[model samples]
Target: MPASAPEAPAPALPRPLIGWRLLALFYDLWPALALWMLASLCFTLGYTIAGHHDPHENIAPLSVLQWALWATCWLLAGLYAVISWRRGGQTLGMRPWRLRVVGADGRPPSWQALCARYAVGTLSLLAAGLGFWWAWIDRDRLAWHDRASGTRMVRNPKP
Candidate 1:
């Protein structure tokens, strides 16, 4: 045989199993909950101060206002996820699990891509987590959000 160049090393797998990603999501909830609490406190204080009412009164908050609070919490959570992924390709939870999010080109995703992923991921969760569950059966083990955003959650070995 003619002299041939040595074969290049194969790259690491870019897809982690559903459990790790789910664990990451579960771990991420702590921060999101903290943000939501902080935000709700601010909203409550503002509303009470505006109405000149005691903030500690046992009262049912307005439904409309409750919805607004939910929206705010959702927005903050999305920002947290997108920012983390954009800056480092991993969040606090993903770090512990040695997981990373990368674009189809194997680089950090664009802001637009991250936003899309966050949005679709929310939808997936709202729909009983079918989107995340998709990974379990997918031939390539990619979630709906990953497929939609042209991004994938990759698994990395321990350092």
Candidate 2:
């Protein structure tokens, strides 16, 4: 009888390039924007119902209420990110590009890690994306969040 042929090993998964990461972030911004708008609408309605003189007046800039609105938006965005990462390791935006967040061992990360990732990612954005840009110089091509959270984003192989 002829010997059976040896099976080939699977190919190594490659890390996603910065361009892909940026594209996913850009896609995610749309959903985040929509959520922020909804939150703003609710805040505006509450402000008007509180007996403000003008029904159509905008929330006063730098007021306590305004600060609350900003905080709500930030929390909401963080929830969106943490939940997505926890549930499936991929957000809506990451789905299209096949990007997934995994721990150093390549398994789903912990909730704490996911939150850390979101927090660091927020700082990265606030710093003009310098954290994201760090991947360019990183030997492992990891972003700031990746390093801080001990998580990494990797591209899945095509099915």
- The candidate that wins on TM-score is 2
TM-score of 1: 0.90
> Scored by CA lDDT, what does every candidate get?
0.90, 0.92
lDDT of 2 by residue, 46-137 (tens): 88888874876676779999999999999998899899989999999999999999998888999999999999999998999999999999
Q: Write the per-residue lDDT of candidate 1 for residues 28-141, one digit (tens) a residue.
A: 999999999998998788879789568887335676677888899999999999999999998888998999999988888999999999999999999999999989999999
Tell me model 1's lDDT, rounded to 2 decimals. 0.90
What does the lDDT come to for candidate 2?
0.92
Query: Model 1, clash count?
Result: 0
Q: Which stretches of candidate 2 lie over 4 Å from their true place?
A: 1-11
Best candidate according to lDDT: 2
The TM-score of candidate 2 is: 0.91
Q: Which stretches of candidate 1 lie over 4 Å from their true place?
A: 1-10, 58-62
Residue pairs in steric clash, candidate 2?
Answer: none
